[model samples]
Target: MATFEATAEAAAKNLESGRTLRELSDLFTPMAIRVAITLRIAQKIDAGRLTAEALAADTATDADVLERVLLHLVTIGVLTRNDRGEFGLTRIGEDMLVENGKAANPPWLDLNTVAGRAELAFTRLLDVARTGEVAYSAQYGTSFWDDLTRDPSSGTDFDVVMAGGMERRIREIAEAYDWGALGSVVDVGGGNGTLLTGLLHAHPRLRGTVLDRHAEPALRTFEDVGLGERATATTGSFLDPLPPGAGGYILSRIQSDWNDADVRTILSHCLEAARPHGKVIVVDEFATEEGVRCDSEDDLRMLVYYGGKERTMEQVRALAADVGLSVESLRKAADWTVMELAPAEN
Candidate 1:
């Protein structure tokens, strides 16, 4: 009876504490992390300046305020405060150091940069939620894609973020599928040829082509990977006809940026290019039905930034059918779903 009473008391305390409100208030944590990253706090700490005063002196911030922030970070497991008033990076905080490469210096999290500005537009989520319109354009006075195109530096940053972050995922994709039988493949909208380079590097017998709006970089990547002879990079839109007769065509994480009509159009182009027995491989996140959200914030990000969506498997199959392709198989590689399609029978 005493144990039951204790359990009941704990449950009541949990309910009284308002977990929902706590979670909602935690949104400020990302901004705090952004600020810390911007000030190179982790790097400063790693460089032997362990006290808040030293960190503030190096970062040109107020010592008292910085100490508060550091204290908050310590509570969040990002830093540890010792009895000597020295602070050190926790495992999570270590990733914020610039020396850690992609993991340490994620371009999107650098609040001073364009990607960070884009992320900040999420504060207008209420406006997007009410209007079913993009918050990015409303916040920034221009569409996300337009802003990227207009600002070369920002665009380059965005590209680096996408390419650098997906290295492990690219390796998983390269190894997940059976590329042995495919003689030739075209990577539609292949950004910087990262995926194609991985694929070609893994399968020596296969030749590949990357169709992207930016061809020079893709070509350079092909050369870097030593697949220059076996791979070709062409500048083109995937909405138009692809290079015909490839054994396999790939649309890796491209469909999530467009609406249903655009997705169908891209798939139709792939269908036109794919030989009768050729395969069309789409790599994207699949929404689960059990109300267990995966990448839910990403879906919101897509909606607010590009008016696109992360779709469910059923929706994807329907879209494939509309484009005259039939779902042949599905494979899971990390958090992404690789949906294989073939020409639909009349």
Candidate 2:
């Protein structure tokens, strides 16, 4: 008994020291995803029978290395390996690999993609937390937003991958809203207008305006989503200004990207654009320190990729009130919270 207890204590210490099993899992998740995408393993098995050898040939990867990765992924439940040595997609894997319909998701989760490659810098999250700044600024000497603006394509992955990945979540939020009575909706910083496009298509009576810094491709996306007639694309920065006279303003996935100071600026813009009785809908991380947490992997991604932080309901309420907005109520969903607030009273 004494020897067993001593061994247990030592194992626990090792588990918590350096990189624990948990930390290693966190570290390799994005990389393993990237490896899968790079090798097109999912694509190979889409129609069902593909030997491990075929995957290496099709993707031009080392057969031995590819086989090891797939085997490891299977061990972790990412992919399934059968007795015949054939590998195939799991339900979650299928959702991520499907090219169309509800199965379509963010390729950003795939590390081999261009955006995923750059996002791997999440290892530098230590620098971000230490200085309250982005490591990108340290290594690249520019802000994440600035880089996207300077190079238009960097933001495209987010528009397609992240937005598409979150489409199901957005659908939940859109359906939850009191759409029975509403006029105009403004999607602030709505990348490629996926949410707006989804919302407008669902609530046809509602006219939508997609406000973004890079409004060019978003305009094209309107036509692509077939909401071109009901929706319009416009240039407006929530951090700077918003379109005048909106019935409700939605800052989905926006506020958490900024610190409190910037959130105030954006909220103030919402207030200015809001009509009397207009509600400001803030869709973001609700700063919960408890159950059903934000994606820890994605949390670290923001800290490393763009130097953003997730916030809680309390943090959001304080920031909104400071910007002359009052919280009316809180609405909860599976992974996000919607703070229904209005311009401050008196």
Best-fitting candidate, scored by TM-score: 1
Number of the top candidate by lDDT?
1
Candidates' C-alpha lDDT: 0.80, 0.72
Candidate 2 to native Cα RMSD, angstroms: 7.1
Q: What is the lDDT of residue 93 in candidate 2?
A: 70
- lDDT at 31 for candidate 2? 67
Q: Name the lDDT of candidate 1.
A: 0.80
Global lDDT of model 2: 0.72
Candidate 1 structure quality by residue, lDDT tens digits, 1-346? 1245555985787789765757655776777788888888988888899998999999999999989888888887899999999999988888887532255565668776666777888888887778876777888888776676566666666666667867788778777888747788898988778888888878889899889766777787777867758998898888788889989999987888887988999998998888577999998767765444445677877776777787778888899998789988888879877788999872
Worst 10 residues of 1 by lDDT: 98-107
Question: What tens digits encode model 2's per-residue C-alpha lDDT throughout 175-291?
Answer: 777642568878888888888877776677888888887888778988887775678888767777677787888888887677677788888888888857777888875655543
